[model samples]
Target: MSEGKKMTSSRRLQLKSLMLQIATKRLEEEKKEVAAAKEAYIIENCPPPDLSGDMAALTEFCKKLHIAIDKIDEGRYDIEAKVQKINKEVRDKQQANCFKL
Candidate 1:
């Protein structure tokens, strides 16, 4: 009986170790996937600046880029606000329906 118990314990330990290894591997894979996605996003949305230009040209380029970024940020904020308002309305309706039920 004692030998059987030892075997069971050993098997459980082995299974637990295997599960941990698998979970660690999955976490590593997810990290890699996230990193690849981040790299792709940066490549697509954040173009590298042209460093071959004169100081004046570079300054002008930076000024234009900053203005464009500000505009994009404003648009994003507006859209986010709208989405939040819509979500709140939906939630309120859901709660009202739940109370009626």
Candidate 2:
């Protein structure tokens, strides 16, 4: 009947509106979470510099920062090399198994 169709359409619109509101809330929460994560990353990895120091003190601080960066880079390189070695070994073993089969 015409009345039934109208009721169904009204319910559909209400559901759509509710879903849109929920989605908007979820999007806002995700944005806040992302912003928090970025702030934490900056706080952990990008410390604020001591700008009130003399030139010599500033130079020393820079040198220390550079050394820390170099150490992190070396550690990353070592891990990458280990991963490559393991991958190569796995491939070699797989090929050997295929040949045996």
Give the backbone clash total of model 2: 0
Q: Give lDDT per model, in order.
A: 0.95, 0.95
**Tens digits of per-residue lDDT for model 1 on 1-101?**
35443567889999999999999999999999999999999999999888799999989998998999999999999999999999999999999999999
Candidate 2 lDDT tens digits, 1-101: 36453557889999999999999999999999999999999999988887799999999999998999999999999999999999999999999999999
Least accurate 10 contiguous residues by lDDT in model 2: 1-10
lDDT of 1: 0.95
The residue-level lDDT of candidate 2 at 3 comes to 46
Error of 2 at 79 (Å): 0.5
C-alpha TM-score for every candidate: 0.72, 0.63
Which pairs clash inside model 1?
none
Q: Model 1, 36: alpha-carbon shift in Å? A: 2.7
Native-to-model Cα distance after best TM-score fit, residue 87 in candidate 1, in Å: 2.0
